[model samples]
Structures are given as structure tokens and as C-alpha cells.
Target chain A: MKHNFGAGPGILPQEVLKQAAAGVLDFNGIGLSILEISHRSPEFEGVLNEAVKLVKEELGVPEGYSVLFLQGGASTQFAMVPYNLLPEGGKAAYVESGVWANKALKEAKYFGDVEVIATAKDKNFTYIPKDFTVPADAAYLHLTSNNTIYGTQLQEFPASPIPVVCDMSSDIFSRKVNVADFGLIYAGAQKNMGPAGTTLVIVKDELLGKADRKIPSMFNYQAQIDGGSMYNTPPVFAIYVSMLTLRWLKAKGGVEAIQKENEEKARVLYEEIDRNPLFKGVCVPEDRSHMNVCFLVENPEHEKPFLKFAEERGIEGIKGHRSAGGFRASIYNALPITSVYVLVEAMQEFAEKNK
Target chain B: MKHNFGAGPGILPQEVLKQAAAGVLDFNGIGLSILEISHRSPEFEGVLNEAVKLVKEELGVPEGYSVLFLQGGASTQFAMVPYNLLPEGGKAAYVESGVWANKALKEAKYFGDVEVIATAKDKNFTYIPKDFTVPADAAYLHLTSNNTIYGTQLQEFPASPIPVVCDMSSDIFSRKVNVADFGLIYAGAQKNMGPAGTTLVIVKDELLGKADRKIPSMFNYQAQIDGGSMYNTPPVFAIYVSMLTLRWLKAKGGVEAIQKENEEKARVLYEEIDRNPLFKGVCVPEDRSHMNVCFLVENPEHEKPFLKFAEERGIEGIKGHRSAGGFRASIYNALPITSVYVLVEAMQEFAEKNK
Candidate 1:
């Protein structure tokens, strides 16, 4: 009965792991353990104020947006979105498209004059770079909407007049978009939210004090949005299991009904890896990746007995990305349409006993 | 029953929260939810290889020390320990003492020629500055062993012909020193390891390629010690609840028996805030802080009825740090000596019912 498809600390939501394992045994009863409380205590300020008002009511996030939650991941917002809004020696732009968008354009060229402009690194990034430009007084363009190790995504985005910033860690929320077309987004709560030491961010309250250096008040996103992310000592049980995986993504029908169950679990595992003749997928099926599908196999020696015949039929983490080898799966937003139907019936029983 | 005196994301260890709430419901059984697996799976590489071999067999840490498990806390190692050990314009030598050792000496003075050399900010820092001089061909001396907002504690660290580094975010492992007398240490796993997106660090393998520049492969501590902290995608359920609080600190006897139960829970709350005349204490009883004690309130209107009588006796995070306000507690290492005897019997029944 196990079937995770691991990518970015992957799968979650068995009632957000039985209410994050009953809030580490107590929490709501407040007998401690939500890793023993206190992110400025009103019981973790009601779990970071109802997980930032359930991400501004499940991502409508407008009315002068701010969010925050922070703690280095999404590679510390690629040097905190160019150290809190570039400014000094300005010029921004970046795009690249893999390995965390060229490691956030090499941490925003160690603080300014960035400008890669656009690149899928000659397609080894597999795709996602059309009509680049965007530099009329550039101080913010950056990208990486999705590229968990070259699976590639961005499906839409592009039309910018400056101010954008993204990194959406691994295809944020996995669907509904337009958080007012960005002015900084961030993500990293270990994919689809709930693990790695939390990182969210959001921002757009006037793109924050226009950076003239001296940032580090914990990488100032206006000092963590004026101390609501409680200035410091956060990462309280990874934002309380990312507020029970955003209240199990607003009781299963929020980000537009979980983007129709994440495009039907990436169209049933990319139509059984494009009609499996021993499989094939690696990006470019219109920049493949509804959350890391990646593939390859026409007999790479049945990749270690098709990952031990899908790990003896429980079908776990699919394995791929020792710089991209043979399988990947991933299906993020709390992956479970019976775990992509047990990974498309274990890739149709490993292509009928190895074709 | 809810007495989490919030120092770090404070307090943990009830058999490491019942084996981290049974590994978020089935990690060992592999039914999944150690936050949905796969940090390069061998079941998260046997949970990051037995949490870096139980921090080198409970901090004996020999053989070219490495450890790592990072994510920007310890304020991103105050600019990744002078961007991976200084150099261009090199210098080093800090020690300022209070607010995060003066924010790691203002981020190692933006990367070079630092030298605060020594300072308790002329006693306003309340103590711990003693005899200075740590220069001798500098490039690494820094300190801050335990000052979670000025409660002070260096209790013996100064024999540096350079290369020391410390931070030990809020007195690491409560007590028991000489992890090969420092050459990098860090701590921020929300005080005494286990939450807040994991920080740890450790270091010292010939301080790795003496940093000339270009870190940022997640602030490269030698690329998280040559990718053993998985070089990226770490912070997996805060390193599996910091390997279930280092296996409940090696079945409760490691770190020299939790340094005699953290010196009998900081000597029964600094002997009831020094025989209470309505509380006092804040450092300098030979540099206090066995792990953040900090106190105050001989009658400044009994500091708002001793923090609303320790938050109506449930005794929560004891307030202080409105830049040194009036009460800190913190007593980390999973805090219980019966929650510092329920915060020194709720500060002696709020000083005998407010004197």
C-alpha cells in the first residue's frame, strides 16, 4: 500500500499524514510537540496565523501581498531575490532553466548586473525559453517556475515589464497561477508543501525597500515582512507541516480542484510513458513535467530489473536523476490518485516482463 | 502539560516525540510519510547515513570532521562563515558577543578585514569578554558559543592561532566540549538539534580549499561536504527530526549524560532567579546562560504581572528580547528537568503572589 514517487521530499496528504502524526502527538491539545511549540506562541501564533491565512485564502494573494515564512531553500531565494530587490548597480533579468535556474543565476551574480536573459542551455534543459528580452531597466526578471532537475515547466509565464522573480521551488501549488504575475514568489516547503525547513516568501508589498545593500537582517524581505514570520526562530515544525499541507489543500478542492487532480496525475504517468516500448520521456513533450515525469529505457538493461520490479510491487520513489537515468514519476501535489494508479500499473508490469 | 519555554523552536525529546511521531506514520515500515521520502532514497540514505553517523558517534567527531545538514539558519552561517573562510582582503577574528555576535560581526564585515577582536560592548553586553588577542595570522577566529540574545557563555574557548569559528547556536548539545576544539561548528537545528529546517555544519577537513570566493552551491561548506548532505534537496523533514533527536541523544546518556541534566536544569533556574526579590539574573554571575537563562524584574511593575503570571500558569515562552526586555528561560536540550521544574515553580508562585 505504499507508493510515494519521490521528488523534492515528495508525497504527502494522508490527511496530511494523520494530521502530521497528530501534531507530533499533542499540539492542538497543546501538551507540546509541534516540535514542542513557540514560534511566538499563541500556539505558534495559531500555526503561523492559520498558515498565512491559508496562503491568502488558498492563493488569491492580492491586496498588496506579503506572505514570508522564510529560511533558506529555493536556495535562499537565490540570494534573497537579489538581496531584497537589486537596486545597487541594478540590472537583473536571468532565465537559464535548470539546476535551480543556474543556481539562481549564480546567486544573482553575487549581487547584481545579472542578465542571462534566456536559455534552456541549448535544450539539455529540455525546453522553456521563448521570447526573452524583459530588461527595460531590469532589476527583476528571474525565473525557474519548474525544473526539478530538468523535467521543465513554465507552461505559460513570459510577458514582463520588469519585476517578476520566481523559483516556485517545484511547480508551486501545481496549478492555479497569476499571483498578480509576480514580484517575487519563492516556494521550497519540500515540494508541494510540507517538509524541508519551509520557505514560501510571496512579497509584492511594493517590492520591498528597494535594496541599497546591507540586507542581512536574516536576508531581509523587509525583515521577514516586519517580523510576522516572527523575525527569527521560525521553521516551527516546518511551518507546522505546512499547516497540515494547507489544510489538505483546502479540503481537496481548492487550487481549482487540485488542478484537476494535477492534470489527472500528469495524464496517467504521461500515457504510460508515451505508450511504453520499454518507456522514453525526458522533457519536450511540450516541456514535460506536471511535476517531474522524466523517463528513459528502451532497454538500459531494464534499469536494475525495472527498479526491482517497482520495488517488489509497492512501487516507491521510481529512481532517476543520477543526472537523469531511467525513471522519475514525481506527481507532486500530495501525489495519490492511488499513487498514479500504482505508477500506471507498475509501468504496465514493467513492459510485460521486459518486453 | 504545555510548558514549552520557547528558546529555539524549543523543547523536544519525549522519546524524541515518540520516535518522531512514528516517523510521520511509517518511515521504517516504509509505508511512507517520512514526509514522502526520496532524498536520494536508500530510505533517505538511511536517514542521511544515520544522521552523519550520530554526529560522529555522539560528538566525538574525529577523522577529518564533516557533518553539514544545512539550510540558512544560524543566519546562513553569517554569510557562510566569511564566504567559506575568507581570503581576498582576508582578515577575520570576531567576538562582539550579543545580538547574534553582532550579526556575525556584521556578516564578516561584508566579506573581509573584520577584526572586532573582542567586545562585550563595554559591559552593556552584561559579561563574557575577558582577555582578548586572537589575531596571529587571522582568517578564522570568530566565536559566539552561546548568547541567544546576551545571556553569555564561552566557558573556555581561546587558544586560537586562528581557525576556531563556533556559533553553536544556543549552546549545542547543552555541554561537553572539545569537538576537536573548533575549526567551524554551527548549530541552528532550532536549539539542540531537531527542527527549523536543520543547520548543524561541523567542518574541519583542512578547512577545505581556503576560500578565495564563489560559494553558493547552497553556500558551499565544501558543497555541503562534497554532497553527503545530498548537496541539495536536504532539510528532509528537518533531517528526519534530526535523526529523532540524535536517537533521543543516544538513549539519554550521551553528551556526558546531558551534561549532568544540563547542570541540573541550569541549577534549578539560576537558583530561583537568585533567591527572588521578585526576580533578577540576566548574565554575569560569571557569564550565565547554561543555555539562555536571562532575567529581570525586581519590580518594574512586576513586568506585566510576570508575563501574565507565566501565561496563566501554563508557563509558555517567557517573553524577553524586545531587544532585552525581561525574561528568557530557554533552558534547551529538550528542556525538561520537569520543564525546568515548571519554570522554577512558576517563578515561585509569581513571587508569592506578587509580594
Candidate 2:
């Protein structure tokens, strides 16, 4: 069996993929592809409305929350959230965890006063900063739930005096989180959900309408909530596939069961990296990402041969980002335990051959 | 036999959809869903490279013109164009044709001196404004190639001393045009390309580093163009499906042949509406939209019955926008000639029964 470990457009459930393949040509035998249907029609409305409800029920979102399926991925929400909530001269505190965290913070600066409360920049973002107090006067405290590139994760969120906004693009639905803990949560539907193009935004209704500026209708929370995410043509096929993936998540016992599987997968790979003298995990042990495990060899010479060996053995996407070179294995919610076993076995074999 | 006439995210060619469905599950038998593949990988890089090449070849874009497949719809570019090119105090001339035109103008007002050179509001936008000169000092003269809601199109683009920036969301690739004539052209992918979530931006390479302020990374044209649209996680599946559609466009004799077919399809439907006394076209004949043909019933009492009759005959998505409150037959690129025939036949039966 082939092992896939690419990040963020990462692994998806096999059953979800199968159902998505079938639905593209004929959705429930409607004689029209899902891509061809009108978003306003009852057929598509049913799909969208159910997906919204599932997000609420599965995450235990409190009542009066508005779930939006938007375009431009999590990157768009970096600007949209601030545009909708930041009044003129308003300030929001942002924690810089990784590349995405820094990008989000930069976008917010365009609208209002944005304060960087804490940053892991000194350590090359290898770990999440801790014990930082959020400003009480800030509108919201923003954090990255998981960083895919540097293999860092915020293990437990710190208490915030203000509302919290999270960019949970990488680790959303991988673990059970109290959705009510934050005022706003946004995720791109790529890693744990379905595909790119669709972003899932869950916002508390009360946090909206504070923006004094004239927010673009497309970026406005009220526009999306009132229009039911169909204010304009939505990313139809991506959303349909996401609905299927959500169903697969439910069928497999949701976040609780998946978290156990995810933990075990990470354990096997991390243990192999730790035991093998030739390889070293990049991130601090306390902050290694459960989703993406970044590692490197002691000698640069072993990197190319190791990558080729892994590829020959049906392992793919082992290369790391150019900025932080080495290797990465992305074990998302849908990655099976068997794939992780294959990766671990390959690492063991490589160590034996080198010795 | 099924006909889908939903405006955007509307009908796509069946062959393209079928191939896309197969790829969604296991992209070329790579054992991974296309959604999970990394954009940086050679596999996805091939997809992007080929897609850009096809767009350039099929659209007849001259050398030095860059093509970018970005996230967010054309609406995002309304602000991005001004943010990137409009120097702090620069002025841009805009033609107010319809809703989208006005929206773009309003967004630009936030940045610089935005001049509304002409407006079709005097004629209720049923016809395109004529006899207006674009200012020489303006950064760019902006226009909407086709008004999706008003059912009007610019048969001939306005001559301008400055570069032309167009929002070609509804009617791109419907006809052959000189790509070098415009400074920049952008379109949301849903209407005629594939699905929502991906926006196509084609701009001259020389049009860079003009904005005085530091633009956000996602909105920065140079950052995206330099990164090859992979500066962040792109809308993968929407783009993959677009590649398939673009491939189909190439195999079916490119945009030139499709344009002929599109014109014929629009002619058939419009002729039938003109001949029938029970129906009257909404826009003036000189300014009718070949993409969206909007028309009203001769008598208000017959509207409900005709709509019901069309629904019963398996003719769908012909209902007009809430503001118009009539029927609009959207004859996009992938809409079959037979579907237009189906709509024409339905209109004939409704007229005979109620006339």
C-alpha cells in the first residue's frame, strides 16, 4: 500500500474519497453533477445547511454561532476576521507561532493597532511560547492551533482576558476542543476536512458588528450569515467533498476516536526518530506537531538516498520545506496506522543499512 | 438529457466532470486523493505549469504576460488591484455599469481619487454607456466585460489612453480578444471555467511595484506572481478541475470554436423570446448578454404558471435574480445547444397554452 504524508491538502479518509469520486458525475443520482447545481436550490441548500449543522453539533458550538463556508482558504480569514470585528483604532493581540501566525498578524496591521504578545521567532519557531498574558483591552487574542512547517503545536491554550481568534487550518477536528473557548475559529478545508478552496469559519454572533469601517460585503460576517454562504457562488465541489469527509469522521466515532489513532501514529514515528542515532527530530519534544513530524539526518549525505529508499518502498512526500530543509511526515486524521508503521520500519531499515 | 442553467458554478462539460471525478479519488492512480497532494511537489507543479501554459496558448496572451490562479473570487481583486497599483494619491477612472461595477468603484474609493467617468444608471443599466473619454493621467480604466445580472455586455471595449483593468467574471473566453489591449484581466472560475474558490489573474509583467504602501502578502500581485501562485496553500481541487476544463477546451478546438458555439446557442434562445408575444426581452437588443439572457413575461399572471410548467418539464435554474423577478437563461460555455433548445421548446409550449 502507498503511504501519503503531504501536509495541508494532506490525507483524507479512504471512504470519503470513494464517495466523492462517485458523486462528481451524479450526485445522489440527480442526473447532474454536484458542480452544476444551483446553491440556492433545495438540493444544494440541503448539503450546505447539513454541513453547517454538523460543524456545530460535532464541535459543540454554542447557540447563536454562525458557521460560514468561505473562499480564499484560511489566508483570507486573516484579513476578514479583523475587517469584521476591528473598530477604528481597535487593537488585537496576536501570538506568532509560525509562518501563518506571522502572516495573519501582518494583515491585521492594515486595519488597526495589532500587538504581538509573544513569538517563538528566536528559536526559529521550533516551540510555542508560554506564560504570556493577553492584554485585557485587546479585542481578541489570535493564535495558530498547529504549525505545519516547523512541526510545532500549541498543546494547551492559555487563558485570555479578551476574545480569542484561532487559525486552526492544520489540526482542526484532529482533537476534541471546546468550541466555546474561543469567540472565532477558522480552518481551511484541506488538512482534516476535504480540499482547498473552502474555509470553515465559526464565529460567535455577538462578536460581529463592532467594525466602524465599511467592510466589503463579501468579507462581512453579516453578508455571509444572512446569505447562508450562498451570497455568491460558493466552492461547490470542495464543500460537497467536505460534507462527505465530515460524514466519514462521524462514522468513525468523530474526534475522540480519531485523536487516539492520531496519537498512536505520531508515537510510532517519533519513537523511531528518537531511537535512531542517525536521525534527529527538529522541533522540541514538548512541542512536536502531531500532524507533521519534521526530522533530519546527522549527515546531509544520507538525505537523498533515504528519500529515494522511502519512495521505492511506496512512501511519498517525505521531503521538507525549502526554508527548513530535511524531511517531514504528515500524519493527519485520515492517515492509517499501517502507513505510520511503514514509515517507522523504513527509518529502522535505513539506520541498520548505514550502521 | 439533463440541463443545468444555474448562473455561476453552473454546468460543466460531462467529459471533464467524469475525468475530474476519477482524479478526485486517486489522482492518476497515485494512491492519494488529489486533494491531499502538496502544491510544491513535481506532480502538482506539473498541473499548475500545464494549466498556465494552456491558458496562455488558448487565450492568445502575448509573451511577458503572467497568468496566476489565485484563491478568493474576482471580488477580492476589486480591492487588490487598487492596493497594489494605485499609488496613495493616484486616481483611476471607472465605468459604473451594474452592481459589480459600482462595488469595485466603492472599494477603490477607500484608497485614492476614484473617478466615475460614466454610469449607465441614467438608463437603468439596460444599455452600455457610450461616448465617454478615459482620462490620460488615470492609472487604469476599469470595466466589467459583461454584466451577469443586467444581461448587458460591452460589444466593443472602450479605447483608453491608460491601461485597461477589467473584471471579466461572467464572459471570459466567450470570444477572442487582443490580450495585450488590457493591462490586467481577472475572472472568478465558477461561471465558465470550473468551480468557485479559484480566480484567474492575467497581468502584464511590467505592471509591478507601483503601490506606495506595503500591501498584504495574499493581496500583493508581485508576491503571488513571483511564487507561481504557491506562496500559500492554493485552492487545489478547484484548480485541478479547471485544468481538466481547459484541456477539454483545447481538445474541442480551443476558445475560438467554443465562442462560435456559444454565440449560436445564445442566438437560438433570443430569437425564440423575440418571436413569442408572451415573452419580452429585458435588455435592449443592442446590449443583450450572450451569457445571461433575461426576459419577462408579457402578462404578470402567466409568470407563475410558466415557471411551474418549465419546472415540470425538467427545465431548471431558469428563474431570474430576486431583483429582476423574471427568467434568465444562462448559456455559458459548457451549456449544450440541446439545453437551449429545451428552454426554447418549453417557452413555446407555455406561450401556446397561455397566449
Residue A171, model 1: lDDT of 75
Which regions of candidate 2 are displaced past 4 Å?
A84-91, A112-114
lDDT of each prediction vs. the true structure?
0.81, 0.87
TM-score of 2: 0.94
lDDT of 2 at B179: 94
Tell me each candidate's TM-score: 0.36, 0.94
lDDT of 1 by residue, A160-216 (tens): 887888888787877888899898798888888788768898889887886777765
Which residue pairs in model 2 clash with each other?
Answer: A9-B36
